[model samples]
Target: MGNLLGNWRFKEPSTVEECDSTWGSDSESDEPAAEDDSGISESVSPAESEWPPGNNGDLSPKLTDSPEFLPKMKRSFYAARDLYKYRHCYPNYKKSRQPNEYRNLRFYLNKIPLVPDGIYIEEILTRWRGDYDKLEHNHTYIQWLFPLREQGLNFYAHELTQDEIKEFQSTREAKRRFLAAYSLMLDFYGIKLLDKSGNVARSSKWQERFHHLNESQHNYLRITRILKSLGELGYEAFKAPLVRLFLEESLHRNTLPNMQHSILEYFVYTIRRPAARRHLLRYARQHYKPAHAFLWGPPPKRSKPKSGDVGASVGAGSSGIRAPAPTPEPQRRGGETSFIPASGCSGTLVSYHDATVCQDVDAESLNAYTPLGSSMDGPEGVFMMILERNNYSGAVPL
Candidate 1:
């Protein structure tokens, strides 16, 4: 029975020891176990372990006795195991955050060899005015204007001729819309109106118009609008004249303090350039005490209650002139203080309540094919190819 059991163990190997004896050798091993001089078993070297050294291996400490090595080795082992186990989880993991469509369009626009001479002034004007289709193309046309302006086309201002300006000045029916558009464009570009002999003509005419309109108590809103545009443009030559006008108007005793405050705020905030700022500041210091106080001083302390009245309760008919019931704070108009204009035209006062008048265009939308760049056949094809390569499935309704 002992002989039979021993033979069965050799053949079937029920225990680990029996299995080792059956297959593994007790001596004459293919690879010998390594030992240190102290007779301690040593770990297999990475090379002997058949593990490829990772890219970061060169940055690791060479010393086998390093305290950091154990943690690093464990991390590497787990990372490798995880990577192997989950390799199929992220098939499309490596991709740029920015879409290829936008990248291609930006590249094409920025790297264009030449802006075609075929892009004429008339075409640019038509685009600016949204002359193609009023509803569908207006927003697109407006969007294109900024790019055109950035490219230094100056199409808006370029449309106005000396003849047109003269006609606009002399004729009441010379197209009010055109006149308004040209005025805005001229002011935006800081173009000083010049006469046939190249003399500055518009300054005196504008000043005379301002005085005449002021006397009639009419078109004050229009005048203020023009003044605001002129101030914002920071026409260098007009700085001194504007400063004088601002000081004279703002310092008048009859002018409401709120109007003065608005004017001062406009100068301080709107005209951003240094020269304009200094010009406004210099005159404001010399001529307007209220403006100076408003700009520099702490807000007027609310008329403080008397020290005697600190803890005292008073009846409705108190002896000390009770501060007229502090006027209930004016309900803010559309989340902003509406500035009353100098003319007290509350109706016409510009409300700065809507902060997002001009919003950022979506990068994806801007990168889509437009009339301006669609004319470029090569770039259009390349843009489409890039879109396809990126597996983009969105419809572009260009």
Candidate 2:
């Protein structure tokens, strides 16, 4: 192990006092390992205790343990440490000897060239819990493999080797296991993984219909079509910083949906709770910017043509915010009209008139869905009826 400790030098000094003073300082040992009560062997390899004790009774200030030493060492040399000493002598590697904070795992992992090379066991052992179960699950695969789908692997071909992909595939049995491993981090938050395998299957079965798209269109389809069509499943909304991180990281144009879903699952696994649906809706409205013509409801009624408001619809003010207009009278179909200001396109057609007289409102009169009339006490007043056929071929009345 010591030999395998590659060229990993302690970025900071390590000391006897630091190693000896702390029990379980060795990340590998929390409880007694296979070794009996002698604690770890006093064999004391150079890697374990090279630093001399100081005159101050503590180890020399220059020899204080590195902050990231344990993680770096654990990740790199753990498997072959005693098995093969030369494994630790890699080029360009630095050994951290101090107390490592969780946030520094990336800093260390970023330096390692091999996949599944090191396990941040100490960090995982301590912080790994139900509250952070999602993260743990996500890192399970990431611990042993890369976090990517087949398409993502293809997209980032240069980053991983074929052997690495094989290693990743071998680590998990089911799709969920693979998903859960990468999903744990995001699940910590309130994001749930939405399985759209059926949709994928359906699309596969009918591949010819979608084959006409060019590569860019295919890329877009790879993301938006399957992912978004799952409706709310594809989205992940969390607290501010995480949300911002996801939007910036996962929502880029080149990002494929499969990748988006994985990254989103990773983030969702991290979220503590699914934020209020309305909160998500608010973000959608602000970000999606759906156009008025694309909206399903009737076009906004013509306003009185207020000054400075130029072709502004009745619902929209100069500020461009769509204000809620008063309820519009129901469509009068065949029967006597009962004036009810319908809140939406569909409403209960309650009438004070007798049930027989309350047959369907006249279809012609239904077109006069006036938004303004006050009451329906007499014949002059409006009657309410839902339009059975939404196909109104005639021009929209102002």
Candidate 3:
């Protein structure tokens, strides 16, 4: 079987010359295949390949061939950088940074630019003041003025004349808007309405207006706001007027409690002088009921029990016979006198009639006494102490 297979067949290997010829034909076909794989290789010239050639051996294309290419690249790079910088500046940039709607003319003014001119100011005032005859003209003026004012042109307020000021102040609407417009300017120019005596004329005007208004027609709330503003603006002249208002006989007591309270608050919290504070405390104690004494501060502290008294009380309690109740002290006419144990040996006794009077006395000296409770009597002692400490001796009449 082996002899038959050998005779039947395996061909001999090709010679080296034949092999070389065959490989040479295959290589010729492979050259075209390789060129097809890289289509741009044949299209690119040696001069183009040598482009941008330097000691650095940069392989990038020469942009100089196309004159517009470098400029366009530079522009694109700078534009991208600028865009990045702008985005970085406002990371959460949005169109709705400020509110569109305003609650009042004052708020609107704050949001707007300052446009200072007489015509523009009058036009704005007329619009807010609801002048129907000049409505159209005012509207047009406002539209133009709004943008300018938003740009911070405040010349309009300075351009106002005394007559214009008086006209504006004649109506509440115009007055409000005008005041809002010039509030900052008033501070800037140190503009104060003063008389020949250097007292604030506005305060006198307000006081006169207050007296003229009937109880039913009185705008206490508005008056209070104005007074508060004046006080905040360092107008000391108004304080006396406020005190007079508090004591006004024509004013309704029931209706004026809130106003009175506000006045007292100003006196108590705002006034720094010892005389002013003493006056306020005296007035409040004389006027305000004992129930309302908490407006000042906590009640006065009670005296602690003595060690000997505690032992005596305990011994009395241990006995079967109950201790007799102490006799009630005699009541004084018009008011009452009560004793309060204050400190060691000495106790404080207060008398209340039209006003309060306090005297420190030895507890052993009194014939009969009663411990003071949480009634109005406590504040009397506190007020008397305050008055005495401040050397205020003038008696307050009922």
Candidate 4:
């Protein structure tokens, strides 16, 4: 996971605006909120610094300290995870662009612009608008840029009212949808919601593998396999696989051990978002509970009454006794487990067991496969799957 982070290069979107600007065509009127830099500023001078710090001026905008903001921050931070790679990969495989086309792209990207260090979107907008002025706001352009802008807008839309949604949607409806989807993704990733006090009102409980649908890694490979089988895979394809995997794993164990139990607990037990709370509850309700199973083996023979058994009731000795039948066991509340690397910090080793239900499998006795020589921190190791021992770069015991 850490390796995945290091390899990430932030992408700046191409300045191509779509020609089909009909969707959210309203003009911008509200003053764009000024960028907040109180926490960390680009221009801090050592000579004027104070330890605890005091107000330099009224430059700081009051920010809502809502705990819900953390996931937004996280999403905005991580959204760039695929931008650079996607930009590079697409041009090579899809089609070759003409030289002028490339020049047009570079112009839109503002290859030369005086962007201020502290400002993010505002700085980019200010410097690049000149180069971007003649560009059309086309559908293709929207599809690409929407994902980038969605991260920030999604974080802010929850606070909006119906009127605000309508007003905002007039110019940025796609932006709103992007935010809605992003918020769902962030919740699934297990980032906790906070209150004013900064306590964990809810903690993120989903594994990183489940949330990162794009990356290839051992834990995610199973999910991807299932997804590709379904055809036309996307983020939504992971939902069923994730749910079913948890169910099967939970039922296989007689008793869940370790913090593994808490993984499911946090996922099911916590309420991080108000709107999707019902959806999560409904999905979680389908897991774990006992049902009757037929017992089959040798049949019992009827015993004949002896001389002393005459005092007993006629059927007592002859008939089989019907003791109270065993009641079915209730299912565990959740079945999720944490994944650990089989070898080094990168090899994939997966084991599910309920020690009381069956014998525990030792890691040493398990088979291992090392392929691709991916370091624990490498992309292949972190994002792809290795199910069997022969699948890896080297032979290893599971």
Candidate 5:
């Protein structure tokens, strides 16, 4: 989350410094701008770089928060890394890897916490559960507290492996700690993980919690990392709705400002529903930063067949990271289809994209939804009609 030297290689969860490299990098300099379906004219890509907080009045930069030591440690870490890197003289030289003690995923399951005076994950869950000041200010504790399958910029943690996940699940106490960690992060984001249904809902403190969220500089990045960790570490079902809530707040409620970049880049595509994705994308394009061509680069043009060979198109979405819709088309139609949301689906849409019970997607109100067939004529409801349009199964609540 800090500055780097040599060729810029910003980690995925890095801070705005990574985004500071000006646009028009060689790859994007000659790229053409095009209009999305929303009719907005711009190259389709995620935001160029996360602008540091000062630009937006909604988020004033916090001059101080992370204890002086954290940034000092980060600076020293980078400096030491460069000293040993010797990039120009020994580009191919391999340096012996030293095992970082803090890198271990299992270490957090123990009672100890990060930092000299940091609180344990359990304490963070209990005593600090509602403590905004401490939670907002803490920096290094996050990566250690909520471990992830993906390695973040925090050098303190190691790469999360599938084996580690299985080990985590098998250990009862560890599982409890991980679940508690989830609760702590969710509550901080103003969401409540329901006990009976195992779904997430708006917390009574959403308004207050949300205000605190906007007040801080780094919460969006934290939210980005947290969402990725949840989706990866077996809480996949809850991931979708948390994303939806942000999209709803920023796009619909107008309550969340300057968040268009995060929502579009990290949140929208996680939704597997074509209709919902398109609906949100179309509306969001106007407000969001023009995505880099690298992100929304042109779909490739089709090539004519030469002999038996077929030419591939990178621009045709062949090289994209997007997963194809699980059920791209329905084999059978005119049958009953349902939109049951998984655990985190209350008051939200239902689909593995993290939709909820039919109750929220009531047939009465869902009639206006365009994903459904035009008739909307049956008692089976609007979701039933929407499901007819795809190879729709249903959400199996976990």
Candidate 6:
């Protein structure tokens, strides 16, 4: 499964802003990136060139995500999964004047920025994006797709900027493609987002993908970055159900073992919506066992369950005929706690967790996780920065 890739061609729009530099407009590899670093500044303006091709003015979610269209899309993704290569990448690495400041911009617009691994944005979306093996085994792609402010395991992917975030948020075409990226990754994780139905649910591939998820490592961080980026990019409505499904498998069905900590600390805490966070916390409180009491504050005072009630019913079939002794409660981790990672840490972790759900996060605290000095225009300078700093690069696994 880790080596499987689907062969889906990038369907080009009728027009593009930057000379239509999209996959349809150019070869998988472009000219040798100019070796000079200083020339890669904002030589070209975004208004003139840095937008991805328009959807031909036809992005009415209704038609694109229709019942008729989705079946084809699903087939397209899974058709060659059984036969494609495990890993496909650029033939060689190249550096040019396309600065890191415009990395997300150029990639989203299908313009001139190649990721640190030298893979073009269009190529990843075409050959590797739908592949289960490439998505899982290829460690560098996630950083380019769901980029975070922090230092990821891969030093190759670019850091994000505030200006890039604001512009990307406002660009309609970028948002559409971002959602496409989100959908592909969700399919890999066994959850499917249904735009036509206006809902999200487990896909037919759920069981197998869920199994692979439990057996893997470092996905909690990936998930946290995804959840955080979704909210940052104006997709708040999508986080809850995805979180609920994972929690259900882990806390309810016991299918995803030893991941309760990662789900709560990393994935759940990264949620930006206040209402959704509270709802998920309440749901977790309902499903989590008494041993995990530290997670959602103290349990309501314990009393023996009376016969014929729901509590008594839950106890009767849970392992033995008789209810067992309750373990003493563990104290909750105080709010505003920073979970610095130690060597050989088991569950994936976030840098911080706010036990108090209603508290407001300051701007710096919001980005307290970043390791780089900041986003830069020159990849040459950033590559040197990556080498000079060990605090962030060594802190977490990709």
Q: The CA-based lDDT of model 2 is what?
A: 0.25
Q: All models: lDDT?
A: 0.26, 0.25, 0.27, 0.24, 0.42, 0.45
- The lowest-lDDT stretch of 10 consecutive residues in candidate 1 is 36-45
Q: Write the per-residue lDDT of candidate 6 for residues 118-236, one digit (tens) a residue.
A: 77666766776458977776666777787644445467666565457778889987777788788888888888888832257788988898887765534555676687567556675
lDDT of 2 by residue, 1-398 (tens): 87766645433113321211112122222332221100001111121111122464422112223332211111101111211111112222232343433221231233232233244433433344234323322322232222211112122111222233344334333223323432333333223334533211112212322222111111221222122211111222213333343343333432221223222222221222223212322232333212321111112345377678865444411211233211111211122233322334332222111011122346564554443333333221222222222322221000
Segments of candidate 2 deviating more than 4 angstroms: 1-158, 170-177, 194-287, 290-398
What are the per-residue Cα lDDT tens digits for candidate 1 across 22-129? 112112232332111000011111100111233543211122333323212111111111111111222212233333332111211332211332332234433434
Between 2 and 4, whose lDDT is larger? 2
Residue range with the least summed lDDT across 10 consecutive positions in model 3: 36-45
Q: Model 5: runs farther than 4 Å from truth? A: 1-108, 115-118, 149-153, 195-198, 269-398
Which stretches in model 6 have alpha-carbon errors above 4 Å?
A: 1-100, 196-198, 291-294, 298-398
- At residue 213, candidate 2 shows an lDDT of 17
Per-prediction tally of clashes? 0, 56, 13, 30, 15, 3
Off by over 4 Å in 1: 1-263, 270-276, 289-292, 296-398
Better of 4 and 6 by lDDT: 6
Candidates in order, TM-scores: namely 0.24, 0.19, 0.24, 0.19, 0.46, 0.51
At residue 86, what lDDT does model 3 achieve? 20
1-398, model 5: which lDDT tens digit per residue? 24544445323213222211112121323343221110001111111111123333311112333232111101111111221121111232322255433333445566566544455665666787878666766555677665654334344555455456566656777757767877887788788988622467778899988766644424665665565455445564565566666767765676664354346544544332334444455455444332211232223346755565643222343322232211111211212233322222122212211221132334644443444122222221122222221222222110
When 3 and 5 are scored with TM-score, the better candidate is: 5
